[model samples]
Target chain A: MMSWLGETWAILSKEWRCELRSRYALSTVLLFAITTLIAVSISVGPAGATPEQRPLMPVLLWLILLFAATAGLPRTFVHEEETHTADPLRLAARPSCLFCGKTLYNLTLLLVLEAVVTPLFLVLLQVEVADLWSFAIALLVGGVGLAVGSTLIAAMVAQARARGPLFAVLAFPILLPLLKLVIDASFVAVAGEAQSPALGLAVLYDSMVTVASLMLFPVVWNP
Target chain B: MTIKQKTFRWLLFVWLAATIWAAFFYAPLSQGFAGKMGDAPQSSRIVFFHVPLAVASFFAFLVAAAWSGVYLWKRRSIDDHRAVAAIEVGMLYCVLATVTGAVWSKVQWGAYWNWDPRQSSIVLALLYYGAYLSLRGAVEDSEVRARLSAVYAVLGFVVAPFLFFILPRMASFSLHPTPGSAEMDREIGLVVVAAIAGFTALFCWIASLRRRVLDLNAEAG
Candidate 1:
């Protein structure tokens, strides 16, 4: 068990080191997020007084995150494949270890993203989180789900042609339930609702996708 | 086709014909909401067709996913073929269900698309399986395609219940009625049941034919 954990950490650090050197994934994802946030701010213009636009805040936030994720996450596997390092890595680490390391790396990237984007979104869109705790919990849980879902999908699509388009096409439907729950939870957070069923749903979605990814990843990774 | 299979196909055809007849001629039309259109008229009959096709589509996907799981375990080419064949038929039935539901909705709700949860969920399912087919096309190597798509099929199936069943129930507003919320009439229920059976049989027959065609192509190639 210790060895396995060590191996996973080794893979994670390797990814981090490579990413630091290239900065390809980090810059592209942040660039996408910032560009999308600016476009949304310009169009919506600092939370117009219209009540109709207020409800769209959560959806727009999630849309930006989703598009940004689509831009960046596939590189976790596609980069390995592109560099022809996947075979050596496959030989060195267990599939589960590789999955854990990759998922953790992706999760970290997403967390950093949410850290940056969420505040900017709130400031620019003028959206208030009535329940800050619930909103944070929603983002945390939703980010895990997004990372888990996208990592597994990225592994599956890494070797395929047209990786970019295929990743979004495959990832969107799988992520829909989680997105719905997160959007709903954010609405409740915005509304200052004491009880948010959407948070519970997000937790459920996170568990389901995480477990499914764990069970299915070995097959995808081996291929 | 073998003699037994040909007979089974004939039986399926007859059963489907009877189901359509019962739907239009025998099943009582559903009453509309109070102070609205008095009854659903002929448009309600589409449920017999639409619901069954939708159910069959769900079943086909389930079968495809099951076979996909089996392929991953055993690495049998036949299992992969069966999985793809089921998905192809499932996609056809899903599209038919969507079109029929849209037509019924247009007549009943005065709009072709309302983003109704049920309708939207079906569209999402279509996109999910459509991606599966596209993935298969995009992969160059047969073994890699089989393995990757099998994994995808299994993963897609796992998420499907949440997408199709749970999320819709959790949503605050849906134009579609909840199952068992309105008690369906016994006569109409029987027709619906029969229609479901007929569609299932039809699906099995089509899937088998598709599998055979795939086998022949594999042999020829």
Candidate 2:
């Protein structure tokens, strides 16, 4: 088990190192996120929504995250293909471990993005975070779930002929439940409602999905 | 006639008899909503068949995905053909399920399409698989198409829980009633179960036929 953990960690670190050196995925994801948010804000209006209705801010924030993830995530795998790196990586480690590593790496990147964007979202959208801890916790749950789902989906779509646009279309319906949970949690966090049940539900979703993906990825990433 | 063909014909006959008997007598008619249909006689009859067909279609999809996984894991060409056959059969069932569900929903909910979670999710499934087949057609090379479709199939499974399970739970706005045997009542449940049995048998039969068809196409070409 520890050896497996080491393998997973090694793969995760390798991906992180690769991304950091290139700065490709983070920059594209961030650029897309910022541009989408600006478009959303403009489309919604400069004056902004009322406070009572401010709960919608989290929904909007996650939507931006969703679109940004959709737009930028395929690059994560495509880079691998372009470099012809996945072949070597697959040969060295178990495919299952590789999937775990990739998922963790993707999840971490999303968390970093959320970490940076959440506060910015709060200020720009005029969302009152009743409890900062709970707010972050909910986003974390949603982020991890989104990360696992999108990472696998992005890998799948990246292999297809039309990489970028196909990823968005394919990922949207499948990620609807996670988006719904995120929207609901965001509502609870903003409205100062009891955070326990909503947050708990999101966590349950994350755990179930994470475990399923871990087991399923071996077959999915079959060489 | 050969024994295999005889057995197949017998199975087909039994399935047809079971389906007809179950639909008419075993399953009781559910009363439609108050005004639109006005408690019309024979209105609740469709529920028995509709629910069963939808469930059978879902079962076919599960089989398709599982087969696709096997194809990738074993890296066998035949498994790919099996997966494709199951998906095609599943797609047929899915269409019938949607049409029946829509018709049933119109009777119960006063709308032809209620953005109800179950209805919406079924539509999503249809669209996802539809796009999948389209992708299969668009790509020319057999190996490439197989590889790409296998990936899409696996990804489709990953996202399924979110659409079918999660969104519906989260959507407070949906008017779709809670799912259960109780919703349909004992009489309805029994009929639906019988119909489901019939549909399952039919699905297997159709899958075998489709497999043979594909082989024949290959031979002819």
Among these predicted structures, which one has the highest TM-score? 1
Cα displacement (angstroms), candidate 1, residue A168, comes to 0.5
Best by DockQ: 1
How do the residues A1-223 of candidate 1 rate in per-residue lDDT, one tens digit apiece?
9999998999899889989999998999999999999988898865442567777888999999999999999999998898899999888889999999999999999999999999998888777778898889888998999999999999988989999999999999889888988998998898787786778878988898889899889888886
Residues B1-221, model 1: lDDT tens digits: 68998899899999999999999899988763222577557778888999999999999999999999999999988899999999999999999999998898888888889988898899999998899998998899888999999988998888887888888887679878787887688998899999999999999999999998988887787
The DockQ value obtained for model 2 is 0.32
> Rounded to one decimal, what is candidate 2's iRMSD?
3.3
Whole-model lDDT for model 1 versus the true structure?
0.89
For model 2, the TM-score of its B chain against the native B chain is: 0.88
Candidate 1 error regions (>4 Å): A46-50, B32-35
RMSD of each: 1.4, 3.6
Give the TM-score of each candidate. 0.97, 0.84
**Candidate 2, B137-184: lDDT as tens digits:** 655666666766776677677667767876677677775556752345
Per-residue lDDT tens digits for candidate 2, residues A1-223, read 9999999899899988988999888998888888877777777666666876586688789888987777666676767766787678667898777878888888888888887777777767666778777778888888888888777766665455666667677667667666777788777777778744567766776777677667655544553
